[model samples]
Target: LGLASCKNNTETLGSPLPLNKNYFENYLNARYNEEADYDPNSPANILREVHGLNKQGKLITQVSMFANRYPSEDALKLFGANEGVGAQLPQ
Candidate 1:
């Protein structure tokens, strides 16, 4: 019964989304200087940095939510992806 319940729960959750490689790459490029000591390719390192930053009491504003919701190429380009990491968003 326990095993069946677990299977049902897993089925309900469905599969996780695939990692957005472009987002990761662009994010890495932008934050590389800020995390120079850690290996950008290491998932553990990336998670650690992100978690650390989040723990610093970062608040989620509406603009951030909007950016996350539309992280496609067009959105990224609008944020100056061509200008490289840490580029300022268009006014």
Candidate 2:
């Protein structure tokens, strides 16, 4: 995430882009403790996971992940609980 200067500044910062190079290969190297993907094929599960991940607690982590250009969260918010670690930092 080092600063770089290019003659062209047409590209917007933070625009969602695909990882098209090896440079980003290690970005998720420290990302661990992924929350369970409850039911990959179930629409209900997909919605639930999205809903859970967008809750305030999880949203904080999501924000950091994007802002910092990496998975910065150290823990996962419980699916439906108020407070508890559902998972831990990447190992």
Candidate 3:
């Protein structure tokens, strides 16, 4: 199903697809593939990232220091968090 490339190259990420083909780019958008391959709502294949807890600890969150990603630093600081979400919807 896949082919290996540069076996001695440690810096490489993973095995290449094949001649003139890319599996990740082609199958990444399939919902059934992602759910069946991994699990429910894994977010591994998602591109839009709203917030994420960089640390694995129970009370830790890795919010972006920049303004656009998350602007609610106060709520995050309540638990030493790092990020939050800011979405506006029309009524």
Candidate No. with top lDDT: 1
Ten residues in sequence with the least summed lDDT for candidate 1: 57-66
Instruction: Provide TM-scores for the models.
Output: 0.18, 0.15, 0.15
Candidate 2 achieves a global lDDT of 0.39
lDDT per residue for candidate 3 within 10-62, as digits (tens), equals: 55435432221233344443332111233324554232233543322123334
Clashes of each: 1, 1, 2
List ranges where model 2 is wrong by over 4 Å. 1-38, 53-91
Tell me the deviation in Å of residue 14 in model 2. 81
Per-residue CA lDDT of candidate 2, range 1-91, in tens?
9887778455443433433233355555435344433345466656767878532222122221333443223123222222222333344
- Which lDDT value does model 1 have at 90? 61
Query: Per-residue lDDT tens digits of candidate 1, residues 1-91?
Result: 3543344233332433334667656555542112224345566656767777422222332221223443565455544443433455868
User: Residue 66 error for model 2, in Å?
Assistant: 51
Location of the lowest summed lDDT over 10 successive residues in candidate 2: 55-64
**Model 1: number of backbone collisions:** 1
Off by over 4 Å in 1: 1-17, 31-91
Residue 48, candidate 3: C-alpha displacement in angstroms: 42
Clashes of 2: 1
